[model samples]
Target: MIRTSLPLKKSLKPKRCRSCGANFNPISSMSKACSVPCAMALNDAAKAKSAARAAKDERKSLAERKAKLKTRREWIAEAQAAVNKVARLRDLLAGHGCISCGARPQQKFGGTFDAGHYRSVGSAPHMRYYLPAIRGQCVRCNRDLGGSAVNFRKGLVERIGINRVEEIESMQWTAKWSVEYLERLKKVMNKKARRLEKRIEAKSEVNQLEAVE
Candidate 1:
């Protein structure tokens, strides 16, 4: 049931202009702009949005093309570099010095340390990204003397315990790393590295505050 309770309006209510928020009596139901200037503004805004979307698509296409040009080995190396970066930062945060020569990493990642592996990637590619199998080592021991294997063993046993070190030593799987797997690994490690950086920055701020106090 319907009841006529109050007085009626003289005409339909004014519509809000899409471009300018001003209210107007639209010329037609389909009209969105209140005036020619507002119409022009709306058109320009739509065109700019379309252009920006097109630019984003073009950039994404270019990145895909560049990624496609890289070889499987290149992908592997890139993923490995990301893993090493995260591993080095991990050891640095833990206050563990070089696993080989017992030299300390400079308080930062500053090219003085390398993420050395207990089993070289050439020998055990399966453990390439394994955290327990890798440690931060001074550049001198990792690059100059080739991991300093004998010393690294003693250090590895102490850090991860003998059972874990032996488990790594006795592992016997043939790892076939795919480009897809490496790509995923790279993205994950990069994310972790960023988080680690934030943690380090927060710790530094705390230390500074303590010193001031």
Candidate 2:
């Protein structure tokens, strides 16, 4: 049970000064430089090399981030979302439920709805952000049947005048959106949507109180 431990093995190679190339027996296994001055010089050089490498990596990372930055497309998408939200709420409040099906929100099985476009975005990319072109519709009519184009056209004409519908249909100009414009539009649309939501909530409260009375 009582056993004596053997001494730890030491490296056979003598320590060499990394800074001056002088060889000597090392005090410890980790001792690389022979003299204090050699060790200090080696440390300073290593620190400088590490700093240079770190600076290079930081520059590379910043350049890559700039290269992969979001463009006008992302801004447009966000602005469109806010616009659609406001349009859907507007239609709901106006009692123009499901422009394609004439199905009221209360009549629908689910509460889900969408701001459907009269002119499909794929067909008219220029009118994607056009507020008048978008109207509220049931999920079934919009997503499942691809907007029911026939009914949508009729409803659109009735909702907005025939002249306006013709104008939008004849529009050939493509508008190039800027990020600044899109950002501003997004804020405006969001504020309008929030105000509409408050009105809808207040109206509901009034109707509920009347029903109870």
Candidate 3:
């Protein structure tokens, strides 16, 4: 038995060198560089790219670890801040007066305005994220005066009606906030705040419009 000659394999299409940008015929399908120097440069480039990618992954992993190390109290605080910011922003946009003291929003006297809870957070941790129970308040009324409960009740009644206020007061509930739940709440509140922020007009723009009028 005799062996016949095999048909010649077709050459692959020319490829551009990754390093020098010149086109060259490759020895095999997987070949990249045209010359030894280009091959070395390409190899160095690949190693550098891999190192950079590894560094990026390490940084991301380190950040995730640091986040995991944060205490539950810190997570709760952050979520609370997000909710508080939205409450204040809601009243600010609506131009509502202070819930505790009838202090006007434009008034210069008073500490910085805050999201005042009608049912104090200390008393009702369950209602911490309750929007209806919270309203705009000055620092003097909210912090310095310890929420001025009687005045807050009256203001809340006037704003939300006696029925709603009473309903909020009558409610008694407990919550077990997990880290995942708190994280989601923070993200949701932040998203709401961002949406509300878009509705706010810049002071300069408002002034210009008023001046034009």
Top candidate when judged by lDDT against the true structure: 1
TM-score for all models, in order of appearance: 0.75, 0.63, 0.67
Q: What is the C-alpha lDDT of each candidate?
A: 0.88, 0.86, 0.87
lDDT of 2 by residue, 12-119 (tens): 678677889989888887888888998999999999999999999999999667645867887788899999999999987786778888877553454478889889
Better of 1 and 2 by lDDT: 1
Lowest lDDT sum, 10 consecutive residues, model 3, at 102-111
Residue ranges of candidate 2 with Cα displaced over 4 Å = 1-69, 106-111
Residue 35 local lDDT, model 3: 96
lDDT of 1: 0.88
> Over the stretch 45-156, how does candidate 3's per-residue lDDT look in tens digits?
9999999999999999997898799899999999999998899888877877788776775535543788888887888999988888988888888888988889999999
Model 3, position 66, has a per-residue lDDT of 84
**Clash count (model 3, backbone only):** 0
